[model samples]
Target: MTRDISGQIAVVTGGAQGIGLAVLRKLVAAGARVASWDANAALNETVMAGEDALALPCDVSDFASVQAALDATVDRLGPPAILVNSAGIAGPNMPVADYPPEYWARIVAVNLTGTFHVNRAVVPGMHEAGYGRILNIASIAGKEGNPNACAYSASKAGVIGFTKSLGKELADMDIAVNCVTPAAARTPIFDQMSKAHIEYMLSKIPRQRFLEVEEAAEMILWTVSPANSFTTGAVFDLSGGRATY
Candidate 1:
């Protein structure tokens, strides 16, 4: 029998644009009602245009802010049975010694701690409901450290470790937790990286191309679907052949 997600309520963090927006669209198309949380105000208008999505402004790095957003979502959309932790930031790239401490802290707060906040907020509802899917978006840099992106790489590596630990803790429950490690995808974050960094990422991929937003989002949708019952605490790779191990 095939699993269908119709009538499910899905919460997608950072669902303003790029891969996050793409995931929001796919989940809605799969018949799930979606609540999209983004820090950018424009995202609300962009994602809610002619769709059934609820767009809420949320700062994932702040627990109070994330809690408020989740509360609002539940009030408007009901309990979220599915979650995708896609909200992240790529801090300024520089050698470790040259990197600003503020930048490093910001990267860790948004990429790693932010994921923690969302998961903490939503997991209780899943536990109460006895079913859920949680997917975190990580990076290939998390697996294979990048030269000048120390903070970004470290934060993502933390996400991977956190996902594994939480997945094990909830193994006996009906909820499944997993993450995806994707290579460079064309998004606004690319503009923050140096041209050399972008070129290096492309060169590392045997496919010689950056991944499409839709391609990444498709994998996320599948991992969060009921079809993904057996693969908790696993990492899915989408590196265009650059991922090894």
Candidate 2:
């Protein structure tokens, strides 16, 4: 039996565009009030369209900034029972030895530590409510390391590990923590990479195409729904046949 998510409040980090926006739209369509936090204020407004949504500017890389944003979100929409950790940064393409230290740290901070901040802030509420759903947005690179994207790969790997560990810790609780490993998608974040790098990524996928944003969101919806009561510490694969393990 599938569970309905009506009237549930969901918070999505990086909810301004791409997969995040897709998730927000789906949640709203399913009768869930949604809040979107993004560093780009304009993008957030454009995505939300002044609906029953709060578009807040947030730098997920900074714990203090994320905490304040979470606080504001609670004040506006009440404590989020569902959280989607989608905020991330794809750093420069380079080998591990040649990757800039600052770039590596930035990627880790945004993709990994940023997830930590949001989870830390929201988990307490879920624990108190005795119901919560956390769906983390990881990447295929996290499962199968890419050649020239060490920082992004490592950060996502960290997310997978963190999700697994935390999921175990909360296994006995009502909170179900899971993550998805998606292949490259046609999002604005791709613009940060070189054409050659993009081509290289595409060629590696057996499906020979990027995963659609809608598809990713659909999976997220199911994972965070009340129907997903039995699963925790699970990693769903969206890698376009690129995932081996």
Candidate 3:
């Protein structure tokens, strides 16, 4: 069932394209005003073109940047009732032993620390509003572990832990904190991984196909919907039956 969100405010990180953009468009269509927070300044400048939507440049990896972006968002749109942390990178594909130390640092900074940043920045405002929904986009790799992708896997696992812990923190409130773990999807993030790494992911999906970005968006839409009450600290699986835990 479609939940009513006629007067809701939303913020979607990485909203410039891919899954974030998918979610942003769906929210707009559902009558919710949206802010597209992305690191791509160009995308933010040109992607959204109307009164109900605006784009703000934000690098989720940077706490200071995340804070500034959050402030700017609240100033432009009202306090966001919904926040989707979709900004992330796959990092370079390599075994943990061969992974570049610097690259590993970068991936965790964005995938894990960044998730924390978005949630920390948004939660206070949500607490003040007495209502909120936070959706973290994790991956199946976080659960089953993936070879040649140490940093990506570890960081996502951290996201799952964080989501679960935070969900419980706000369990008594109207706020909901949850995460969705998806199998590989053909997003631009694929540009960063090796062909072997990509194939490895495809071979693992029992469905014999990669997930579509829109399908991920649909799950995100519901996770952040008002109808999603009574569910927090939960992990919604979208791994083609790869994960039912």
Candidate 4:
């Protein structure tokens, strides 16, 4: 049965812009009450004006922040049945030998640990409701390690592992935990990368073009929909024909 997510509450981290905002828009159009959880208050408010999306200030890297955000979201929008972990950072491009310790820590904090924090906060609600959908935004760099991106690759790899384990643990339940690995999209995230790095990513894509945020968001919506029943502990590929597997 196709799940019409009408009236279901959804929380999208990093919903201020990029793929997160795109997903937020789609979910709202699908009849879901959506919350835009992001650290960027100004941008979030700006984007959510007429969209009617609740804007919540959340720093996913911090467990306290995540818990508070989830609490606030539930109080305002009702318990979220859909959770999308799209908040992440692409550390500066550099060889592993020259990678900054601080960058490595921040990358892992926001990308890997952040995923853990949000899931921890929301899963209990889903468990109670006996239905839930989670989608983590991973990266193609994790599958085929990028040359100058060790922190990003490692952190994303951890996200993949975490999703797999969480999905398996929840397979017996109605909650579905899965992640998607997408090739580079022309989001503000690209501002963190170097020209060389961007060109390298483009050269690798058989499609020879960057991904669109709308394209990525559509698959994510479907992944979290009721139609996706029985597909858990899996990785969905959106790598522009780059992933060999």
Candidate lDDT scores, in order, read 0.90, 0.90, 0.91, 0.92
Q: Where does candidate 2 have its weakest 10-residue lDDT segment?
A: 44-53
Give candidate 2's whole-model lDDT.
0.90
Lowest summed lDDT across 10 adjacent residues in model 3 is found at 43-52
lDDT of 4 by residue, 55-172 (tens): 9889999999998888888877789999999999998999979999999999999999999999999999999999999999999998889999999999999999999999998999
lDDT of 1 at 195: 91
lDDT measured at residue 20 in model 2 versus the true structure, 0 to 100: 94
Off by over 4 Å in 2: 49-51
TM-score of 1: 0.97
| Model 4 alpha-carbon drift over 4 Å, by segment | 49-52
The whole-model C-alpha lDDT of candidate 3 against the native structure comes to 0.91
- Model 1, span 1-245: residue lDDT tens: 24688889999999998789899999998999899999997756678743456898999999999999899888887899999999999877789999999999999999999999999999999999999999999999999989999999999999999999999989998799999999999999998899999998999999999999999988888888888888899989998889867
Error of 1 at 41 (Å): 1.6
TM-score of each: 0.97, 0.97, 0.97, 0.98
* Residue clash pairs of candidate 4: none
* lDDT (Cα, tens digit) per residue for candidate 3, span 1-245: 44788779999999998888889989998888998889999977877866778898899999999888888877877899999999999988877778789998999999999999999999998998889999999999999999888999999999999999999999989999999999999988999989999999999999999999899999899889989998999999999988889
Ranking by lDDT: 4, 3, 1, 2
Q: All predictions: root-mean-square deviation over Cα? A: 1.2, 1.2, 1.1, 1.2
Error of 1 at 181 (Å): 0.2
User: Would you give me the overall lDDT of model 4?
Assistant: 0.92
